[model samples]
Target: MAHQTRIPKLASILAVSALGLSLSPSWAARSFTPQAGTWVISDEVDGKPGRGFAIDVQGNTFFMQVFGYEKNGDATFYAATGQMEGDTVTAPLLRYQGGRSFGSEPRDAQEDKSIGDVKLSFRNGLQGTMQLPGEPAKDIERFIFTAPDAAYYQTEQWKTSSRMARWFGLNAQGQVEKSWFAMLKTSPTEPMRLTLSDGQTSETLECSLTTPSDSIRCVAANAADAGQAPVVKEAQFRLLGAQVAGAVSLQAEGAAPLQLLGINTRADYPYSGGVIVGCCANGLESFMPGTFGYAQRPAYQPSNGTWVMDDELTGKPGRGVSLDVQGGKMVMQVFAYRADGQPTFAMGVGDFAPDPELRDVSSARFSLQQYRGGRSVGGAASSGELVRDEGEVMVQVSGRTGGYGMPAGSLAEAMVQFPGESAKRMRRLPLQPWQTLEDQLFGEWYFPGLSYAGRPLTVTLNRREGEFVTNDDGSVRCQFNTQMLRGECQWPTATGTSGSSGPIELQDAFALSNSYVRLRDRYGNLVGLGQVPLN
Candidate 1:
């Protein structure tokens, strides 16, 4: 467990007093919202696998369902729902029985009785504690399966990394519009470029990197009319995680400068240069992509793909869920084990709806069903019949939009109930690499428009070395560690003698779907895009 520092009460009071503020009752209280997802007992995670709590919070209402085992190792579940005060909630734990099971007819589970009361106290969004009846308080935390990239290509080598930015401002007709910005940036030394589009026309601008005063000066990158004044003068903003909020100064032709408040979503660390800097030219405010009023704005959608429970990827027999969304309909299949340890599955199909209070969250509820009498794979033909109303399942998908209006930062949590059992919480698994460094890069590659002599170039690479042969009988060799993704390549002069050598960098070599690797020089200029043929 990670250690956390606790501030002394007297010290906290002294610190607040030093800020020259009165210690009011409201000011002394702390508030927190528990992030909705799967949580586990921190210390007992390894010893007690297959047991966890699914917790969800909307406003001050808290809901939790625990799945575990009885003394004889029989499966058991419990549920609790209550309103939270500050950062804590206590509620009665209830059990149920007589729910429908696989191959069983439709039946509703009935509440058996209250077992005991449970207390939950949250320290923050990700960490908390839980106290069950007859058990000591246990430390609990959100199970995080996904971790961000630990390294990135330098700006000098990549030129520009593209990301989607959410922009909010009034269009040319003086009506507010929520749109997207194609934000492009190199390193701190290069100017930040932005292009705002409403799915029709677009406006572009170039702005300096964030200044000391937390502002960026902008100028027209492309002007419709020559010798015209720049469309944007300046912008001042703040960056919090992936969110950007601030105000911009827009200059209309023959009009006074207009100050418009705006907010944008930015890429994660190192790419954003730790500040908000973007702009747009032309009359973008007048063009709204969809409707005029914010009420008619389109909701963000989650991308359709395979999702897994992050912490449970042990290549062992465990629970998993498959989600398929088509238009407004969603179908989920959960594969797990029965109380007697037999493998079983439940399916749910329903419609997706956006959360009224959370812009980034969408949900669906389905009547759970199970099937039986199915044929085995590659066996005799057989049909399966559904056992309706086996239970209920609810899924919540949370995500954000990025470049090309695609889903980014997508996360999902599900509350699943079986007849006679309590709901269980499950979360989408994080991305995992399926290929090795050698599998991705060891081969012959072709680069077109790579030679100064106008001849196509072909390079052969092994685990440790790469050779580039020129059309003029000149050859250069590079030595690199594929695991590091960096190397040095020697340059041959006109006389066919080794002249100079510089560093070589490649990006996204192990990307699962990539057919090529981006090659760049030490100064970040594009050397060639190396493509490998399909086997």
Candidate 2:
């Protein structure tokens, strides 16, 4: 009988309303919609910030969607949608249609089954509010659509190529379990207020944004222990997107004044460009690279390798394009010849790596600047990192407004040509034919998942030789290299024992992230060691 493994589950909430407007019979015939789009989370009372929501009206009914981290202890999102009747932007707890959380997958939580009454309202057709029924204390939140995309073009962070970000709200123990994502568009003129909530206690602080040498600084609107100025008792922000500098700071004047280092989150997925991420493809549907931040193009210098053209495209800019690299950097103007012999700007991506020691030709990032009749409406960007051959770099520029985030990330795709004519354009390009992970796996790897089991395995591999040791009684030792599967092993081929190693083989050699591969036998067959890493 196969054992039943348990999967992680998320505990979260989902959500909005009020304005006294003309409720007439003609109101049903008249169309009603928001004045602006991209309503961002601006303020929250007795709740968390960084939550963005939207509203849509159809005839006598109104629909809503709430996004971002909720007050619940769950560190992930508590997104929910609802509908109201009779021209009122209000709904009972039962009116909530459906919902989903962002972190762990749903596991039949009672929180998803229970919802409190909600009151919603819009003012000037640009702002909105969501609260509990009849009372103001439950929760009152606000979102504004007219807010600009602050992380791009206009901000100091974007200008300096600091486009990547992840944030969280910390507690007094100097801990930040739940992430508090703040993608904000603040008033450059007035004081920007932030509500820091830790489930039980809350602090409201007025902050001023100052620019000194293009670096943005946030200072308390009022000095500490002096006036009505609320102090920022606790907060943890880890800005890890910069190329040269990154920090995890806890800025509480009287409390922990430590400028710390090391891992912040439990799962320390590489934050910097080192650990490439997949295409964040869940929410953002209308993203275009270079318009906002620099998009990335990952590559590995193949010594004397050259860029191949996928000229199947004959449209504007040749539909397909490949970049030329010199000294690990691309030139300003890139163009490709069309079928008619006319040259047009070519833009696309590829992946290949030589050695990090010789020349780090592993990745290249770019940003697209979009223009409509020479006027800039808004923009978005992408990133291309060193990915395996199943090989793809899922570049989803994350945001709150305009549905920038989803279960995976945001989804916005564009096709670019690669090396061969058969190699078509794809935003998520996989260089499976050119991937090399043999050198990357040259160190010692311990199987953490198997530590608790009866026999834990310790694997040590190198370019020339390797060994697998069973820690239990130190009873087993298997030495194998690129040429041979098993150099030596105790109790080999005995009843109920591990099989005899044979000619070395590694299945799906490129997908190491999938963990432990099939370890075959002398005649090249499964040794029951498959799924060993995660098993």
Question: RMSD per prediction, one decimal?
Answer: 25.4, 29.3
lDDT values for all models:
0.41, 0.25
lDDT of 2 at 41: 30
Question: TM-score winner among the candidates?
Answer: 1
Quote each prediction's TM-score.
0.34, 0.24
Cα deviation of 153, candidate 1, in Å: 13
Kindly list the per-residue Cα lDDT of model 2 for residues 319-424, writing each as its tens digit.
Answer: 1112222222221112222133321122222222222332212333343111111100011111111111112221222211211222111112122212222222
lDDT (tens digit, per residue) of candidate 1 on 277-301: 1111000122235765222212222
Please estimate how well model 2 matches the true structure, expressed as its whole-model Cα lDDT. 0.25
Off by over 4 Å in 1: 1-31, 149-535
